[model samples]
Target: MKPLLLLDVDGVLNPMSRPTPDFHRYRCTVGAEVYTVHLNPRHGRRLIDLALATGSELVWATTWEEHANEWIAPRIGLPSLPVIPMRPGEPSEHGEMFKTRHVADYVGGRPFVWFDDQVWAEDEEYLRVHQGLADFLLIHVDPGRGLTSRHLGMAHEWLTLTGFSQGS
Candidate 1:
């Protein structure tokens, strides 16, 4: 089975800083409110490169919704990747869990690694229960720095263990 790399935009590819000129700017509306976002295109490119090299299918698991392809993909150099849209009618409070389930469904029988900052114990519990025999790698990004060298190292290790890649 092909392995999947579930990518989250905000804190993973795009650091949630106020302003960063090098990053791609985005705006979204949540019901009555509008918000702006900045995506670190350089880091996004780096992550995309890793995804391509490892032969892992890339799926968008962010609140960007369907806009991930039009707004996020071209900026990051991945235009043709398939996006896993957030679950319909999912409550905003449990968006993280919704994303997790969407990712699981997208990958189907394949192994997967989910990179996100908002994941909690609930998400982990859900994965533990529904993952069945396929390996589910949950990579939690830190608040301030997103994914660090240590985080990547850990992901690399997990990828190796799951036979997604041959570790260096």
Candidate 2:
């Protein structure tokens, strides 16, 4: 099976920092809440290239859930991707981030690479113990910086080492 590329919206794609020339500010309304997100349009192409090289499928694992496809994807030039159902503000039993349990369940035994600003040491240990032999990489993106070429490079390196490359 192809590996999964899990993406988080708030910190991984839409940075909280001030916008750069390459980043565009978009005002999105989800229900009654309006969110202003800074997105780099080029990130879409970069992510798609990474997935193609690694033979991975991009999946959304964020609080935005279905709204990511509606708001974030189009702004960044990405096609609709599958979203991992998220229960915002719900606490995890393992004391890790709220998304940890849900992410574990969603990937099953498939290898995956997850990019999120909230990833902690506890989450890594929990997944290491629970995921068994399934290889996984958790990239901690700084919310101030968002996704960068370095982050993409790290993912590519990991996928290649794990034999998840398209040429594998």
Candidate 3:
């Protein structure tokens, strides 16, 4: 199966603290209701380049769903990307569990790389239990810095472990 690279919006890509560092958030009107929206990789070209280079498919594993591409992608100089909405009926749990479970569902027997700062307690346990998900990588980033070469190295390690790396 082709590998899915699952990315989170708020803390992983955009970040809660930055105004669109790698990611960003804002309030906007959607239809009749006002909603807080987020944008990521304010500079997404490099990220997009990296993903394409790695032969990994990108999926928005965030609460933003389709909005991620709609409100966010253009600013970053890229087109829309596929989205993986949060778990249905899961209620608002911590960001990590929500991401973990949802990503597990999103990948659905495929391999994936999960990039987010919120991969909490349940995430570790779930990863521990599901060894086949070993092909799955849980990449954590500091909300302040976004994805860095260090994080990319981790991703590279994971990709290598899973035999997905295209070596130089």
lDDT of 2 at 31: 100
Q: For model 2, which pairs clash?
A: none
The numbered model that scores best in TM-score is 2
Candidate 3 weakest lDDT stretch, 10 residues: 15-24
Task: Tell me how far the alpha carbon of residue 40 in candidate 1 is from the true structure, in angstroms, after superposition.
Answer: 1.8
Ranking by TM-score: 2, 1, 3
Q: Order the candidates by lDDT, highest first — what do you get?
A: 2, 1, 3
Model 1 misplacement above 4 A = 19-34, 88-96, 131-133, 166-168
> CA lDDT of each candidate?
0.69, 0.90, 0.66
Candidate 3 lDDT over residue span 104-148, tens digit each = 656777767778887766686776565456466778778776666
TM-score of each: 0.77, 0.95, 0.75
Please identify model 2 stretches exceeding 4 Å from their true place. Answer: 131-133
**What is the clash tally of candidate 1?**
0
| Count of steric clashes across candidates, in order | 0, 0, 7
